[model samples]
Target: MHTRRSLLLTAAAGSSIALLGLATPNATALAATSDQGLVDEARITVQDFTGDTQFTDMRRKLARAKGVFIVPQLLKASFIIGGEGGSGVLLAKTQTGWSEPAIYTMGAGSIGLQIGGEASEVMLLLMSDKAVEAILRNEFKLGADASVAAGPVGAGIEAATTTNLGADILSYSKVKGLAAGISIEGAVISARHSRNAAYYGKQAHPRAILYENAVSNRGTLELRQALAAAEMP
Candidate 1:
């Protein structure tokens, strides 16, 4: 059983590594620039989600969201052992407008009969102040630190929207042009302090970046614009 589990994990890691574009011999170099690339990808992800018809419910939720965390490419690999992980950016909706993004990472592992690999664009709409606050921490587990529910998509959007009001966070994801329910109940979201500092050229903390407005980067302007447009009626 132990050997089987190790094989499963190895397979899953290989898939994730490929999805991250780190499977090459030059992976070390690519890793150096991944922070900036992640931000750029995040901008594209927001634009894609807002413009896509399938994400109408997510856009609606974003109108009232206190914050948003966007994972441009969440990778999952499963074959008896399942693992999901990705790097993302988190931004707060402040009284002035959207704040600069702070880096975060999501990862989880589970045992199941699932088989296959998938990559998706994911977003977490922070529905309440509690949800936003919990995410600002150094690390937190989804469904344990804050209430979370899959955001309604397609046919059930209206009904689920009303019923999901009490959930602190609403998650939305898409893969290959179709909406997907990426199970993230036990995922850990932790701050990526080094990335945050590298991106901003200073020591930027999650709270300061999202809440205090302590730093700014011209590169992220497009991402903020996309979020603003998505929230419009």
Candidate 2:
């Protein structure tokens, strides 16, 4: 158990360092750039996040989420105060269906009980109309404009019975052997204006893509499929 934990931490830290721009240019260049490429990458991550049997409860709740944000890979490296960052895509559950994803960036700094490096899979399910509204803005801080909590995972836990519905959003992170929940209390979620601009051929915001129903799911077939499975009642 001790050796496994050490490996998990080491792997997480390594992923974090490379993703956080602390690695060489070649390593950094491997990070997703084109919007289509990121959408493709995040789809694979979503598969990993939901594939485990342990996520049954969380997956059920995700189906009902007003909007779901997928941070495929979040890297964090720290000695005292560490920096964590990742890029991902968001899909709003429209009246019709899940809309195309809008790319976004999530970042935060921590100085608490964290010691070594960590890489994680971050997911946020917008649980309320107001919570979805809070994320549509230019820059939104978790646990401030809207409440956020780690969604319960694993078997035997009933999503409807275990969750605090008052929370606007439920967050989760799965890191290797440590597949449970983690807090993203102070993280900032922002629309990737440049990526959106380049991808859509103009300046686009989360408002226009997710809320207003301007974009369609052309390149997000896999992601939408994964979300559809999670949404199944």
Candidate 3:
């Protein structure tokens, strides 16, 4: 039984590596001149890819999410030889603006083939603060550190799902310029504070950028407007 299980694990890992080959390599470094740049890029990508119709739909869905994290780009590579893929920022809506991105990593397991490779954009909705807080840490793994469940999308949105991480979470995927029904199950997310801080050229905390303020360039005005509109008594 032990040997069989080991073989199965090896096969699953091999399959994941094979799937990643479909992604093209990008030479550009993951650096941002300013938080606004990241936010602007994310907003533009979201609008451009999702289009007015789907973008509107996503926005409405996001608005209803408890929290969202926008990472602009999530570069993922497997340790055991695999292609690399990136996902745009993870954004969570807030009374003021979206929360700063927390970093996490994910790997495919047996039973499901989290196949496909391409630098696509992704959006995650944190249904509970527990999961959100866990992401605030510098590093996190999907299956190891925290439990993750496949997020519901589109018509499946009406159904409620729970995660073992003490929070309810949902995810959606977009490739090139289209929404996909694919589940981002084995994928992980965690904070890249050292890298992110280096990009921003400051000693600022990731939370400051993800939660406290809107760091993107184009969204500053819009974020401010949103905050003003949500001003508390």
Candidate 4:
């Protein structure tokens, strides 16, 4: 039984890796800028979301959002022990403007009988001060550390949804040109210090990068532009 189980697990892991390869064909191009690649991908993701008619409300919310965390490609794979993880960038809007992005990695696990892998884009909007505070900590779990809601979409639906939406964090996902609200209740989101340090040429904390010195990185100029373009009229 032990040997049989080991074989199954190995096969599952292999399948997961294969799926990622097919989804992320630009894997080699991913690290072209080292840490900056995530920033580029994030910009494209924001464009894709706000450009869609279904996300009209999502664009509206952006004007008032305190912060936004974008994971351009969240590669997810699963088997008996399901796990999903991806790296992302977070940018907070302030009186000055959108702050420079900080690196983060979110992951989750589930145990059961399952198979296969998939890829999607995820965006988390920080709606309130409390949500921002909760995320600044070392690590936190969605639906546990703070409240979360699937951001309502469409013009008419948005009005009703926002009125009833009381969650701190709003989640949205896009897959194969389809966009909708999603729940990431059990995922663990944490800071990625190594990525931060490597990109910034020093040890930079999330708090400082998000609030104080967002404009410090010249490479992020395009990212900032992407966010600005997503702004609605």
Per-candidate local distance difference test: 0.81, 0.72, 0.46, 0.74
lDDT of each residue in 109-166, candidate 2, tens digit only: 8776668876777788898988878878888899999998777776656735456667
Model 1: per-residue Cα lDDT at residue 94 = 93
How many clashes in each candidate? 0, 5, 29, 1
Candidate 3 Cα errors over 4 Å, as ranges: 1-31, 34-37, 48-60, 71-84, 87-95, 99-117, 143-167, 211-233
**Top-TM-score candidate index:** 1
TM-score, every prediction: 0.84, 0.80, 0.55, 0.81
lDDT of 1 by residue, 1-233 (tens): 22432344345335445546333435533343556567777877888788888888788789899999998778888999989998889999999899999989999998889899987889999999998899888898999999999998887578657778789999999886578898889999999785576567668789999878788888888889889998854
Report residue 38 deviation for candidate 4 (angstroms): 0.7
lDDT of 2 at 69: 87
Selected candidate, larger lDDT, 2 vs 4: 4
In angstroms, how far off is 228's CA in candidate 2?
1.1
- Write down the worst ten-residue block by lDDT for model 1: 1-10
* RMSD score of candidate 2 (Å): 6.0
